[model samples]
Target: MKVKVVSLLLFMTGVMTFAQEDLKEREQQAAFDPAYTSYSRKKPAYVTLKDGTKIEGHIKDVDRKKGQIHRLKIIEDGKKKVEIQATDIADLYMAPSGLEQLDKQANFFNDATKWGKTDATKHLSKGYTMYTNQMVSLKNKKKPTEYLMQVVNPKYSQVIQVYSDPFAKQTASIGVGSLKLAGGIAKSYYVKKGEEIVWLTKSNLDEHFDRLFMDSEDFKSKYEGEKFKWSLLGVYILDYTEFALDAQMGEAK
Candidate 1:
């Protein structure tokens, strides 16, 4: 009986040891696994501070809350790392590091800008910048379109639903809410023409395009002929603008 008891104790000890070894292996694998580590891995980027200082490093993490990038962790000098607040950062550019030549040329900028409302004094707080380009052109303007891009977290659109509960004394109630999952990241596009910045949408696409290309018969013919798809409206408008600009340039030469 004593010999059997000693054998059982030995077996339990061996089982515990094996379990611990397996757990340790899993922990080590997870540390190096791409799926688990990708979010924490640093990516090359250039950061510009509000005071005009520039820092080049690898981005360790970006903390986005309420649709704003509140903070960023950057790794520098191989071993040193620093956390920076959004207020101190002017912008950041994530360097493209893919095989495609076009991907290499792509620059993603995270910058702050005052957006929304027609009144210059009524603009909302700074928001995240998505795309910046001079896609729209005004007649006789020396410079390209100032800035045209999509912004996130500018403002929330309210939705209200009213319903009556027949079972509960036929009481009528109203529900008001907005997108909870947006986290304030719901986006809207804006364009700056002269001194005014206005929201862009599919409903107003024709009005804006007509105003910009009022004198271009070629543009009108081509634009009217193509069937615009809502999902591809942004792309179509950009392409049409480019075509118009090229035609104007050719005429000048």
Candidate 2:
């Protein structure tokens, strides 16, 4: 009789353990599960938190209780001198994007091109391609568009590669130099743990880029296409250790 009771208790314990694990799995799925596969259109939505912080990137998840942004993405501004990214600015109004969003943008541009409505917006090419000399010059001159390349996936973009990641272990980092709207050079450093830094190397991920924009907003009249200027633009000539983020990386050289 005692043996039967012991066996039943063990079985019940196993069932409870499985049930708890299932619940955790569900929670993670609802929260951090992969939402993007190749050709998977991710949506764009501005998540306004209680603190009035607005960002222009895609929302990964929202932590309303903790007042935080999860998995937010922003374009890297090529000009700024600080670690904070200017594209990280959250707008009071949020824009939406999904896999279908790409098709929509394409369709809209296609219709415009089909109709020759050049005044509407400049037509955009689909996916990454070698930039034309004119396009390259314009982007290099403008700066913002040049840095937009980092928005997708730096590793996949293959423009800038991570040669090292010493924080996690020995590390290597790939850096490609880009210009700010005002002609300041910025190098983007990719860390192995899927983190990207545009100007300065370290990031907490939750910090917004509004200040960077505000600091760099002086060249409105000077730069023609997309106007971006930096306020405090002191250069940082430090080794990779300055970016001290808490993620595993390959090696630094």
TM-score of each model, paired residue for residue: 0.38, 0.19
Runs in model 1 deviating more than 4 A are: 1-40, 50-52, 78-80, 85-90, 95-218, 225-227, 244-253
Q: In angstroms, how far off is 95's CA in candidate 2?
A: 8.2
Off by over 4 Å in 2: 9-11, 33-88, 92-253
Write model 2 residue lDDT over 155-253, tens digit each, in one string.
122222222111111113321222112222222222222233332233421132332222222322223364222211111111111122111122332
The local distance difference test score of each candidate is: 0.39, 0.25
In angstroms, the error of model 1 at 223 is 1.1
For all predictions, the C-alpha RMSD in Å is 23.7, 22.7
